[model samples]
Target: QITALDSDTNVHVYAASKWKTIELTSQMNVSTKTPYSNGIKFTWQQSYERGNQYCLAISAWRPFTSLCQARAADNYISGSTEATNHRRPAVVLMGCTDHHSYTLPERPHVIVHVAVWTRQGGPPLARAVVRPFKKPRVPRLQPGQLLTLEPSSGGRALARLRLRRGAKRLFVVAVACGANLKLQILSSDGSRVASVAGGQGALHLKLRQNQPSALKMVMTTNPPGAARTLLLAASTSAKGLPLPRLPRNTVVSTIKASCNNVTLQWKSASGNPNYCIMLQEDFNPGGHHIRALAQCDWEDVLQHPVGYLISQCNPGAMKARRQRYLVGHLLPAHAYIATILVQHPITRHVLALKPTYFKTKEDCSL
Candidate 1:
């Protein structure tokens, strides 16, 4: 299940049997596991150019403190990690570059580790679900405002949130134990952006916002009895979370050049879900002049990525790739110096290894 939250997105894998998201990772459970899980291969597209590094997590959790506790847990035993009140998937997929393949990890037959590159996002900023014998006035939450909620009739609460710039998706969720409640998302203009009513119960919706927006949450419901304590929370996705970086020493194993075509090969890293290879004739390196184009400007790294030159998935890395980039005929017998950049699929960072220098033969061919 892909829950796109603004520019960020949440990739949730479910067992074929239940077909629902996990509890804590998603809040679809507290502590439960299916008897059997499907093990066929599942494939998903990871486009680094589309800001692949912009995915974060959001959830419907109580107190939001439980999430912190779950993260602070020690590496659980593969068989069953007692990290939280429940069991979690043993293997979580952080990510892999385009060069690497992502394989699900399982604990023998006991459990399947949920694939999580990293659970970086946290819950909402605050919770104001209130329950009081007497009803009181409720006001809409303002942008960038944090209001601590007190118990009152039809208790009122507000949580200010800001979406990341260039965000493409937004996820909103609100849940109250009782019925007859309303959840509304207000935009910066103070107009109602989205609301959850009509017995829809909890508010769970993924919204689309291209630019950064300020939002406030307003929840209003019937006054609760003193005995009943209201509980609810909300959160949004963000970009620039901490993520692993691609390894170094990304040398082009072999560079074979025909009069026209040039084939470059390299090995794939383990944690990388995909790879991107960029090539350019200019961008001189050092020496006399320029040697091989091994590095690019920092700003121009991820800009205008030409995509991976090639991709071949088999048992082996299949590092060897042939590029039929002939300008028509062949055999110029000229020393050509070119610069290349390999992209980290997840982070979109560029790795410029030693430049590859190849020359064409003197002979001519058609």
Candidate 2:
């Protein structure tokens, strides 16, 4: 039994040849004030067992209830792992704050639950440590500087990087060797700015002064191996390289229109460039529509696009020198605007071409 919200429960079982069962319960009074002011860290380690492995489950919650059924709500955080020969340790980090707003309370209390079991009915031997520690200082990053991050024992690394002031655009490049990497960039207020997952890639970001003056970089590697390294670099100018010229005199025309689909054809550019087609809902396609779309970031356009496609075209090999794209799964009788864009093969920068406006047919199914 557990009565207190702020308490640690550890269960241990000795190794045995045959199946056995043991149970223990304890209760404590709830404390009004939490002792762990900074944060709490949970660590579990187990010895290797040849025939069987231990499965561990750990969770933390707040605002305790009397009924045991109320513990199912993991409002704070939870983690689980299976202890095997390759992976022998499991760790969980919890902060003393509300999950919705992430704000620290004047007095905080939390309940930590840990459970362990084995498949073969063999006794599992494990140890758990729960302690509170002060927050660690995060290192800062500067522009035009390269930072190398070594993989941690827990397979994640986090750091804070500052953006250059008065720059209209910023580019971030990341490369990982011998491992898969997932990188996420967040603003100061915890809002996501950009995220990329691959072995190597670059992210383009539009900047406003003092809006998101600082960014947090979260990098994680697969397998939790020790030999992985992530190289990160930021710059205002893309290594003194100029962006590719936007495609000129591009034309788009509608070939067929239906209640839920639209077929369009556009003439390819002279140089046979790689391009992307985007469809967006437009209630007002006026003089300022193209200007507004041009000002939006590429990531912003992807959020609410009705249809999108990317491909390369070779005008020299085609008879009509026109590419066809079918935009489907649209609402009936809805107005939409289609825009063409040419993208750089290496840097991933995109420039908008001409846009065409059209509307879907009315619903005929009665």
Candidate 3:
């Protein structure tokens, strides 16, 4: 008898006689081999883009069941690597005995084959189930926020999910092959709410609820592919909690050079909680000959003093403007310039001020 099995999709078929398996395998073109004692076994794994075809075949066995008696359904291996190729077919074979009586107690001879084919590029896919143990307090989706999927190696058509809370829209996007996005919506009861497919792979879903909305992303490949579901969490109420706090006004108030050490000070503005202070040596007022010297963050400051000091500006050399902050951190025996800057905390944009040059004691020497 002939039979067919889908190893990739976790589908199997078995018949008592050989002819049924041969007929089924012939139509499917499932590459299959038959063993007299063990029957037929099928196995496959791979994903193909549009306009690709895979084939399998098994036709040696005789007919026992009618050729058109096979049933088709969504194999459980949906949303899997084997399903990425889209539409596919599987075939197998079985052994038959002359007398339908007590048949020889031997393994049914059978062959199995499977193949995947596609027409247009497959659609973007996603997981089909999501379960959150802890509900969000006040779930809200924000723009530019990142969404991730767990166990994403199985050819699921989603990488990240972006949200436009005001628009009440969710963008389902692909990570690996993310192109040609479309929008889709589904009901809370896990039913086909709405779907759109096209050259785009993004989806914009309307919010069905006002409160904290929780739902899983259900994924479907083009065809002959698997389906999957993923959990989606749209609550970023406490996000951006760890963002770096920038400095406001970066002013060079004082620059003192004693031996090889240099101390620089600046003023802080409104929103900046911290500051980045860099001291450069070989400083040129407008030239690029200066190299970075001492660098530090406000958190590393010994105290919340109003001034910052950069020691060892030139290692052991005594230079004039040559030892200064890029904004002009320099001190000369008779001429020195200091530059100040003010930065925005959130924007990270820098506002600069002209450098103030001061003349040192005319009699000081290294």
Which candidate achieves the best TM-score against the true structure? Answer: 2
Q: Write the per-residue lDDT of candidate 1 for residues 220-280, one digit (tens) a residue.
A: 6543432132233333442221111222334554355666666655544433434444444
lDDT of 2 by residue, 164-272 (tens): 5556666665544445567788998999887776431222333333436788988776546633565566656655222323323455788878888888777654334
Residue-wise C-alpha lDDT for candidate 3, range 113-156, written one tens digit per residue: 22222212122111111112232232223333333333223433
> Which of the two, 1 or 3, has more TM-score?
1
| Cα RMSD to the true fold for all candidates | 30.9, 19.8, 20.2
Every model's TM-score: 0.24, 0.30, 0.22
Candidate 3 segments whose C-alpha is farther than 4 A from its true place? 1-244, 247-267, 271-276, 282-366
lDDT leader: 2
On TM-score, the stronger of 1 and 2 is 2
lDDT for 337 (candidate 1): 45
Q: Can you tell me which runs of candidate 2 are displaced by over 4 Å? A: 1-133, 200-211, 240-366
**10 residues in a row with least lDDT, candidate 2:** 95-104
Candidate 1's C-alpha runs over 4 A off are 1-248, 282-331
